[model samples]
Target: MGSGRRNLKNAAVALLSPIPSIIFYLSLLNHCQRISSTASDGDHSLSLSPLWAWCYYHPLLLANVLFFVNVNVLFWVISHIQSSHWMIDLYWTVIPVMLVHYYATHPLAQYNWWRSKIAISLTWVWGVRLSHNYFRREKWQWGAREDWRFTDMRLQYGKHWWWVSFFAVYVSQQVFLIGVCLPLYVIHSVDEPLNIWDFVAIIACLCGIVVAFSADTQLHDFVSRNQKLKELGKPFVANLDEGLWRYSRHPNYFGEQLWWWGLVIFAWNLGQGWTFIGSFINTMCLAYVTKLVEEWMLKQDYRAEAYRLYQKTTSVWIPWFKSSIGGKDKKA
Candidate 1:
């Protein structure tokens, strides 16, 4: 009887491994957003109910339910999970980051820069569309089941031990999101701009947003077409080899990395000095998160011999480059 049940520890490890940091960070942001709403209620006094109750009740129960439900809803409408791309989350975080970064660089509180307006505008446009698209893709309902990872966790944690698992998932993610958002506070407080670097930063931020949008749209088209091909038994092919995929194995990822760093660059250019360092940290975190995702997915395809060949011939994290042996790179 015991042998028939999967180990809770093993399930937790599997559920929590690979991209825990990323999900935690996302949940953290969601929690912070909730906290911010509370602050807007004009209650300066600290509240213990939700924070205390929910903080310890994360990751295991709350986080998975929220995240999994979110994903399923997105996939249901968009035909794919929209925000499943970790890049989308990373890039979305930039909206707050830009506000914080801009405010930090400009402390005089008089400069009215149009770039901030544009950045913030594009940020929301991209974010809302992406979020809505994701919501449409997933199939979510009351009493709905969970993804395999969470199911695995339930087996190991024991049927009676669900609350603990829920706490782990929820609380951990809440903390992670809040930490990453610290940069927003710094960026939002600024009100001055100096040096030519500020303009350059603005250009970079705008360009990054545009590139990211293009990359995501292109990928969406590619994936949709590929699915049709699969239905027709046309053999799995890297359709990305035609458009933006020709230049980079992950153009969307590249654009997303740029989107975050672009905001960071803008903040530094505004003369916040050390605050600009957050860009590097943010970039590293995103890279690590995406790397984990790649590893997880790559290992799942047991019959992916052709996919393996593509991975070998193409760049994994970076843009593919033309080797002396001849293959497409970012410049293709």
Candidate 2:
């Protein structure tokens, strides 16, 4: 049937989309090997290929180049083919882990071995936790849904969505993803020994993970209870204000920021304080995203009043005491 053929076509597209990026990576590796051999011969001439030279001497630049080819190009192609940009969300959980390993394993990478191990381990923990939450929220379905914001943008862009997504979804991600992972690069690029700041970073990172995990778990349960209420034809709960939700309108966002900023501590400890730029930009972007999310909530007829009250009382990002101005609503 046509449906079967269409499914097959999509599967093929998904499988083949990364071929170009894979080929590019292999070629780059081959070039790097050649350069290593040439350098081992003590030939100090400037006859090296410019691209290979840059990749060899500048790992971060090489990462950006690979990110452009893999995420911006290949991810966009697959998103276009699938008519959904959900893959980016899935990869978001994985890419930081990839970047950390990439920087740690790069031929020119220089860092304390134990520090690199700690960074890699923490990143994997974060990635695995996020990926698990993502899959659970999606009912373990792949590419079945995207972030609601993208859906809204798709409607806003109309026929132009195809191209607009290339920038909005893929291009913007390059900035955010690479920016946020700058700490990993910093950790690998420096040869700093263990210090007290490492302990601080470890505590901060672990706390962030714990907070995010707890908040997400509470949210999941709230959503699940709401779904059951709907299934049983009972009235739905308009807003969640219990647990971490009571203190912060977006504890998960706060926790995510904490995680990144925690990593920034590592970079800062390594004397690369400028690496905070990535986490700062990410926090700014999340602020805008929070605004959009609140606007969306306000637009919903059932939850509008409840969420409005919640917003007035709850801190926006940081978890804190509720405001006294908006008396706790009995309905929420």
Candidate 3:
């Protein structure tokens, strides 16, 4: 989950506000130029919904706009029902499935079908793992818990949070998604056959997923063990600078950035090198987003000195840097 920061939310909105329109505009322009309302005979055999009849002229743009709209509306409704900020968190992982389905059923599906499937497959694997992690953290329950930052913002904004959240939290996040996933919107529809870039992209994407899965699993187990230890009236673990944590303070964040870069790679060779802005936007988000999360976390631990020492030794984002702050004796 993003763990919204009160100060950052407004800034994030300012920084990311332009992307959604750009994506929608580009999507509309791209599809309007090439796509048509009528598909060839074979596409008619697919058991697509009647909605496709309306989307005939601009299937990708239609899917793109519909998805972006549906998600924010759904999140708004869920937030009212549960008053939880993370109501939209799981959507981050799961929405790609629907995206893949939409593109796969498109007339362009007949173009680079297999390569697109590979991209979708990698997305599915990462999505499933990430969704499971969120659920395992018990975030799926409506009203069970609300992220602290949302609570803070609610107090800070008073009644304004009702409207502000609709834009800053929900809409802004969708803009980020639409921008970063633009390649997915662009790639499958093209009729190019598989190329070397596709293979390289698949491997890099899988590797990123593996890194993320491994890092998140490690953190989950560490937290779980510490919870049990606390329940048993024992001391909690001092530092988490173990495993991938040894290399990067936030390995999962790094891995996700890598994963999106891999997706960018998929479209890079198809005259889509310019698509990296999406990945760049996400990387910029991670740069301070993790710091916001850590601020909240540090409050929970109340171990400023230990965490500071840990921070000094460990690289903040990248891994395998030339520093060993690892004494293991000092508590983080």
Candidate 4:
């Protein structure tokens, strides 16, 4: 029965992978047609520049298409990988995709020009690279399930709810993507030249990139080391004491917060005035996600008790202090 269920799941992934692209493309084309028709009805109908029209209307569509395509590919590839439960694996990417959809449909998209452009660009880059990297790292196996989180979710959601769960997963990702990238819309709206605020935003973005890349690199290295150890018949143990992990229980999470908030800062620099709402939302959501993950990690491993210590000492969302001089941030 388990084997049969796995086969069904793989088949479902195969079928659904291609559907998102078609839907994305169709939606984009439809939106374009609407915009063109609307423009043609105005007095300056003939004056509407084709280039301008595309520049203004195409970024969101392009971003959506890129995100959908990458995620679908990820689904096809990961579904075949015999590792990790599928549902939890789906959560990471799914949340972001939902944010994408939300931003695409949000009022900010209509008002924040530069914000939209930056958001679209960042989404395209992050989604494509991450998806490709993920697909390349994992191999396929027939009748294999996905990430353990997915399995847990499947059990929790019940056996008869896969269809609903599937759509929810997809839609959730769209909304996440939209929400996280909201600052881009605000950033794009700026009509002024770069200023001090832009410099501040640039610094924040650079810091985010460095810290995020460093944390991920460290985590990957740790995982690789563990795999090597396993190959030598060593038991798997939680290794969170060294490097950035020592500083914060979740340095990668911290970096992620910085990256998104940095994007929000960019929107602030662009100063679309009311577009600040997008930045505010992004920051708030980042805090919430970080908090949730921290709590979950704390629960997942009580033996180490390192997470609780790290939480107490280090700043939750910001990488502000050193662990050595001050000791674990007693008031993290």
Candidate 5:
């Protein structure tokens, strides 16, 4: 009975976690609408307020402000309550979808309607796939576990994790989430007609989604098989070097990068090439993350030698044919 009740509570928490954020966004949207109406009616009282004016005129800035309050502040408190920071990981699949719609619904939003729809629809597809993967990895249990990286950091920081996490987990996410979604802002800010680049972007984004889905599926299946083997007292597989893993050490990361870079094409085609900065920064961060992940895998006794060989032959990313080099460890 206790376990069942706890499961129910967790399910509710997962379902309702976004309600406060949605409410805050809607409230802000309504306020922006009011400001727009009042300003048009020559009521300078509200428009004269710089904060309101910025919210009305700058949707990108408004999103950042909302992130500060909703994620940085609200999520931070919730993490303390739950004694976990995994909620941010879940929201990573959510916030882009919200930000895209926020840009579309804002009164100041101006763009080709068809283009906006395309971008918004793609964002939804990406978010849904990612959310599905997150839930699957969690065994459909919300907040069951925090990320291993966060667990490591907690151990590393000891008592200081409480405050260190405020900056490390939440603030860093503010930068990453907002940065990656900059293309959404670009898509909504321009009024350009669809062109060849739009079609190119569509292809690239779809390809990314497919590749990521395949890689993650393969990885999940591999892990599940290993678990079963362990349970049966059989020797579990030490490494995965088949399917997408054969071509790239991290095909999933490559696919995710492809998706973001693909989105950048849309903005670039619309003459907002600077929007690439977001995707570029994301890629750099991913590189560092990839290093950390590799280091972790190498630390595992069973995986160390096999992964070293895999690393020697497979590309770090960008899915290419395996190298001709043998599995012998390179001398320092």
Candidate 6:
């Protein structure tokens, strides 16, 4: 009976997981394309000049499509060889740099290199910090290195996990990544002088960077210190609900979400209102990650009760909502 139930669960997950979700999103993308197709191509071209002229000749679409396909192929191949789930993450840090660099490379936009520099430099900083954190945690391992959340899904879903990983974990994120990064393409296209949007982006970006960087550092330190205690015959602590964590259950996720949205402000200033989709999709992705992480925590040996209590009191996503403290249980 247990085996039969497992098979059923796996089968259900296979049919209903991220692929269908992404397909629905693709339909949305199609709708967006239809709506946007009515706009004149004259608008897509840089107003600056014809120097970086080729990007207007369908290069952006080609580059995006080709790069998107290549990354998914890498993810699909690497999924089978290494369960590490690192491939998706590696690109998170690496690709934004490429994207901004892509923006900066436009010869027509050379007059506005300052704006591109600001965006690209900020992105590079974020990428470096995040990738370094992952590296320090030794998550780059090749074999038997899947994220705990992914492993939980594998166990619950039974035998079809590889396919699920490809669809849900990998392929689904491609468009979202590019979409959330839409700001990168546009921020470099415009030649506007510094304005309120620039100030907003700068301030928000710094706040986000500090919050995320600090939160990760705190968590890392907490984990490291606890590991040392365990090695010295102390009990392993279950939660690190102090500092920024006291205010939010997922301060790290919160900060990162703000980080991308902050970057979107520049795109909005460029009259690329539709580019808001990029940041929104990424916010949804982060929320999903937060949910899965909490679920995974609940499944741990000594974590169920502690995290249940933590969940009762802590804000799930927002950074500092006082009302969330010691609040009633809210289901994920």
Which candidate has the highest lDDT of all? 5
lDDT of model 1 at residue 238? 44
Provide the lowest-lDDT 10-residue window in model 3.
6-15
lDDT of each: 0.47, 0.86, 0.71, 0.54, 0.86, 0.69
Off by over 4 Å in 5: 31-51, 326-332
- Rank the candidate models, highest lDDT first: 5, 2, 3, 6, 4, 1
lDDT of 4 by residue, 1-332 (tens): 98668767765764565456547545645555566667655533244357434534556665565555556345534533643335334335344444454455532245344445445555555554444334433433333445444555667778554454544444455455555565654444344555576557656656665676677777777777878888999876554556676666667666666666667676665654454454456566567666666556767753336555555555554555645425433422
Off by over 4 Å in 1: 1-119, 132-184, 276-278, 300-303, 318-320, 324-332
189-255 in candidate 3: lDDT tens per residue? 6768888988888888888888898999999899889989989999987668789988888999988
Model 2: ten consecutive residues of lowest lDDT: 39-48
Better of 1 and 4 by TM-score: 4
Q: 329 in model 1: Cα distance from truth in Å?
A: 9.6
| TM-score to native of every candidate shown | 0.54, 0.90, 0.79, 0.59, 0.92, 0.75
Q: How close is candidate 4 to the true structure, as a TM-score?
A: 0.59
Candidate 2 error regions (>4 Å): 1-50, 326-331
TM-score, predicted candidate 3 vs. hidden true structure: 0.79
- Across 94-203, the per-residue lDDT of candidate 1 in tens digits comes to 33433333333322223335645544564565465544433333221111224434444557777553454434443333334433333334344455545576566566
Clash counts for the predictions, in order: 50, 0, 0, 43, 0, 3
**Descending-TM-score candidate ranking:** 5, 2, 3, 6, 4, 1
Query: lDDT by residue for model 2 over 188-298, one digit each (tens)?
Result: 999978999998999999989988998999999999999999999999899999999999999999988889999999999999999999999999999999999999999
RMSD of each: 11.9, 2.9, 8.6, 7.8, 3.1, 11.1
The ten-residue window of minimal lDDT in model 5 covers 323-332
- lDDT (C-alpha) at residue 189 in model 1: 43
Candidate 6 Cα deviation (angstroms), residue 138? 1.7
lDDT digits (tens) for residues 1-332 of candidate 6: 76566445533432333243235334433544554466476453433234323433443564465455556665566556644564565557776776676556533334256787788889989899887876667533322144666767788877887778777776777777778788888887677887888889878887888888889989999899898998999887788888898788888888888888888888888778788888888788778788778877888868788788788777887876434443553322
